[model samples]
Target: GYHELRHRRVYDRIWIEYHLIFSDDTSLQTSHDISHRIEDQVDHLFRKDEVIITAHLEPESHEPQFASTRDEHERSPLPSREVGP
Candidate 1:
């Protein structure tokens, strides 16, 4: 399952973040596949060149918490990729 963590505009580009929580039994490959599909959908919904998506994958048992401040969020360790042309 997944949840949209936040969305904000940085300059002229839009940034969207999501938390993709998976059960302990879920495989890494499966998680990557799901995240990619989500990225695709988001790309299709918005102007590809103007949107950036940051997806974080977490184990279901882990506590669901977000950065306490925007500065922290910007420095998050999660991998982020630009998703459009």
Candidate 2:
């Protein structure tokens, strides 16, 4: 039962991101509906067309896992992008 939420304002526009925790057995449809309702409620409460919200649904029983490859990827530098030849 944990959640992380963050919000920021850019030129009078509100941007919000958060994660919603649900039981691992919860159906995808239910989780989607919940996220939709939250988005709607936040939009209505803010009463601003510029308000943007992002909600990530996650399982409450999630097991944190770490892999050496993942750690290496994080530490590795990004590949350079070649522009015009």
By lDDT, the best candidate is: 1
lDDT of 1 by residue, 1-85 (tens): 5556798887768889878777667799998897787777676667635889999997766734532232344432334454555
The residue-by-residue lDDT of candidate 2 on 7-84, one tens digit each, is 898886999887766667889999888677667667766674589888887775562332223343332121333222
> Which regions of candidate 2 are displaced past 4 Å?
63-85
- Residue 77's lDDT within candidate 1 is 30
For each candidate in turn, the TM-score is: 0.65, 0.67
TM-score of 1: 0.65
lDDT scores of the candidates, listed in order: 0.68, 0.62
Q: Which residue pairs clash within candidate 1? A: none
Task: Supply every candidate's count of residue pairs whose N, Cα or C atoms clash at under 3 angstroms.
Answer: 0, 0
